[model samples]
Target: MRTPLTAGALLALALAAQPALAKGPATSPNEAATARHYASLIAGSQPNMAELTLFFTQMPKGGDLHHHYSGAIYVEQYVDFVDRQGYCVNKQTYRIETDKALVAAERAKPAAERNCLSSAEIYADDHTWRELLQRWSNKDFFNHGALQPPPDRLFFQTFGYFGPVSNSNFKEGLQELKKRAIAENVSYIETMFKLSPAVANPDFDAKAWQNANDDAAFDAQMRAWFAVLDKDPAFNKTIADFVARIVDSSEGIDDERFTMRYQTYVLRLLNPSLVFSSMVSGFKAAKSSDKIVGVNIVGQESTNISMRDYALHMKMFRFLKSVYPDVKVALHAGELAMGDVPPEGLKFHIDQALTVAGANRIGHGLDLAHETNATGIMQTMREKDIPVEINLTSNAFINGVEGSHHPINLYRKYGVPYVISTDDAGVTRHTLSNEYVLFASRYKPSYAEMKKTSYNSIRYAFLPVAEKQRLTRQLDQRFADFEAKIARLAKTAAKAP
Candidate 1:
């Protein structure tokens, strides 16, 4: 479901939109003039793409709330990391098939039995390198025929291919994300990441919670599961290790200067026991660690396993909430579409996520329009003040939903809060800049409205109340400075010979 636009079509559209800019909101006379100036420079009339890009790139994007660390990182960076660790790639699968430990284990065995090759051995040829890039991301993917894999499969399968490389490149990967985020003028990031592996519960009774008939029974069942999990010495060690990994990954970054937070997650497609155990460990980690702020459920929401266990997972979060009251939950709900799943499937995901699981924020709430009592749901969201993290590129690429079909305009109409974000920039081959460009060019929001959405990200973030206040102040100063710079640039251009 990647943007179906071909390269030639995109170029043609860009060249064709060179007449006038859409009219933005009216404000005070001075402010309206500034808005007009800002619009003019970034409008389709601006012939220089570089200037338009720069104008928006330098514009302060307050924060990105729905980032995935592994997906946020450039795949080439992971390739470089794999090569640095002396790991090797699979030429056929184009996957990072070896890790440092695996290589060491291979060395302990007979040398000739090893099944690995150097990065150079695999990527020495230009064709091989291009194949690897295609395998790891959705770049230039429009030309593949029906004989080739579908777009969703190509996009999701890349995670499995680069899983090993990303697992080992935490520090370098974060540095890459930080560098890019800074460049795009994004000041804060609430990126989803996981460093925890669950220790299998020997006495796990998977059926105890699965067949519960009522909320009370389900709550009791999960409480029993947690009671047993809390006693595992090895399980406790996993939580500590997960927190240590985050701190280690962020050794030199100053939170005071550049803000960042982690949201550890449970893979929704996994077995119930594994997912539940991961959820416990993740929320426990968040309760104790300053770095990990919340928990989320990952994997495609429309998959069979996830769809079946969706409410059960929400119930699990509801139960865990009583145990770890301090921990936050931001779920990926309503990423489904009528085209991809049955109409009935979209009815209550965002609804249950908000009302049942007590989600603090919702990510990719694309099916909001299809929910049962959709207007009431939007009303509840406005009342609860929970924000939706809108990933324009991800939604468009994954569900083929954008522009009018997208619920963003509805969200605005109903007074629901939403923040713009880049869900998987590396996978989608886009950036925060690309997202802003889409929003500005498509929605034509005024300078104030644009800045307000940026502000919404920090306001609804799961940080401490004190930190939120500080960030709000910081954004005010940053936006003022950026507007001044843009104004000067506009004035200088007007007087040009």
Candidate 2:
């Protein structure tokens, strides 16, 4: 008969099982002192926040792993796309319209004889330009309080305004994003963009698409569905074109100081059959080409349809994971907050996303505190090493979660893995560097925590084995270089004339 373990022993075992903090063994005393000295220099600089901003802007961020590719381009740059595509923008509503026939007809007329105003024409109207800017981004807005629609509504609506603009300028969007990432000293990005639409959905057994009777039944149902999809040449071409577009988008993008990969997503707010079918298509695309790294399910999680079908989507991911065991899934789970969603609505989203959906990483995870068995869910995440992609500005803009209510501190306490990201930098009018600055100023995390989180972003990225190793080494070198520069600056400033 074995003796039961003591409380201390059990506690130690449990602690050992949880994921470790990104912080490794402590640095030498001099290195620690130098870090503290640099922190003081940053904190004590003239016009301190500006200096702090500069510090973070120049800091070597590992990567932005939760970026939305379309949402990463600035609104002004998006306007440039509108010009290139010859799209029209409504002056009153600021909605961009792309009627090829209308454009052709207008071009056929004399320039002064045109009926509709093209986006270039709108840009020339200084009075109306700000309206399009505000419509497309969080510019001139402070918080949810200042937004016209509910913040969530406003945030999601920006995507619709630029949908037509985005399709025509994927390459431009990437080049701009890459330039911004390089400016911020970031090295890698896993940006989400929608893949081309899948072929027509097969005749749906709506019930069959909903919750599978059981795991085995789910497998049978999905196989039947795929059996139908597998026959369509249209579907095959669509998948190939989707994969080709991703590579095509990277044509002029420079990756010398930057590495980027695509995460194609299914908009989860659609019909259940469409959502699952898109996921199948997304997985196929990502698997067919290395250009696309993985697949995700996007769209607001708190709405009636999504909330209702949340578990079913997880089941869909679960079933798909069985088929493409190697295909990575980093889902947008637990993005809901208290007021945005009902209390019960928050309880099981992150839980199901982790357990049932087979999400390798969770995006946002704002509702971690409200999940049913929140503690247990965290423990499972810790044990499984599932990192949360924390999007600071996006959460602040959409969910009004920040300061003490934000979950990163709890994530720290529990040793749950997490990495900072820019969810929709263009829409939020922010960047990965802005996230670092906000976290540093708001949370007052130490330099070590900063380094750890930066490293963790690359460590937890969905890149392939060789790429992860290469980026990790690059990040390590970058960190060392940054630390030396900061320390030298601090020391030199102390002895200045």
* TM accuracy, model 2: 0.90
lDDT of 2: 0.78
Candidate 1 regions with alpha-carbon error over 4 angstroms? 1-33, 41-52, 99-117, 120-123, 143-147, 201-205, 208-212
lDDT (tens digit, per residue) of candidate 2 on 233-271: 877788888788888888766456888888889887887
lDDT of each residue in 1-497, candidate 1, tens digit only: 01233556544543443221223454445445557675675566343456556767887788899999988787778777777877777666676656578766754756445445456545556666787778888876876542446667777888998887777867778877888878788888988987456655434436734454477876776688788879978789878877998889877654655788899998988766787889999988898888889999899888888888888888788888878888999999999888677889998899888877888899999998898856656666766788888999998877889888998877775567789999999999898877877776666666666767788888888899998899888887887777767667767888999
- Candidate 2 error regions (>4 Å): 1-34, 41-47, 104-116, 143-147, 199-205, 209-218, 252-254
Report lDDT (CA) for all predictions.
0.77, 0.78
TM-score quality measure for candidate 1:
0.87
